[model samples]
Target: MPETTLRTTGIDHLVLYVGDIGRSKKFYLDVLGMSVAHESPRHLFLACGGQGFALFEPRDGASPETDRDLNHVAFSVDAGTYEEIKAHLEAHGLEVTGRRGDDRCIYFRDPDGHRLQLVVPD
Candidate 1:
């Protein structure tokens, strides 16, 4: 018998727990230009068209910088925006890395130390 698989269109949303919802919200809004789709006392949902993400207040003392788990979120951008994105991140005092200059993606971290990436569409 074959294993069953659940079909899905794509990622509808993503959630990230942050030490401070306001700080995280500001970072995403200011850096990525993500407008708030919804807001609550301890959560802010930023709309990214079909897909969006939420910044939620941390519980039980979760540490952002000390977390050893290696996870990152990548956002797709236009080819022309690749350089502009890199420049924007740098202008914001973010430490951006591409591993190699030829790489189609640049990696950086948010104020909460959450890894983020910007990749150009193929």
Candidate 2:
């Protein structure tokens, strides 16, 4: 075995498997305020700040299963804007859960049952 150090940067993109690409795309774009970087019939690329995310439609009729206890995606937001964002999500009919032990985070789920969080850095 060879000993070598592997250096890597931050996440470039994260792909989420969705049953309906169009509905997922609209949720990300309209709710999260992400911009569309690219799109196709089966996939959508959305810009998140400097990084990006992709929505992929599975050919099979099954949707992706996310572990309720551990699987989730979190995005950062300004501390001042935290309350406004939470309120917006609620106004849009999404259930938002405040962190049990922390005051700086909220959890919610997307249309595809993917858990997502909005967090404010201290």
Give per-model CA RMSD.
Answer: 2.7, 2.9
lDDT of 1 at 100: 37
TM-score of every candidate relative to the true structure: 0.80, 0.83
Tens digit per residue, CA lDDT, model 2, 1-122: 66769756898999888878888888998988899999999989999999988888877776565553348889887544667777899998999988634568889999989999888665
How far residue 30's Cα lies from its native spot in candidate 1, in Å, is 1.2
lDDT by residue (82-113, candidate 1, tens digit) is: 67777888898999988435668889988878
Best candidate (score: TM-score): 2
lDDT of each: 0.79, 0.83
Model 2 clashes, total count: 0
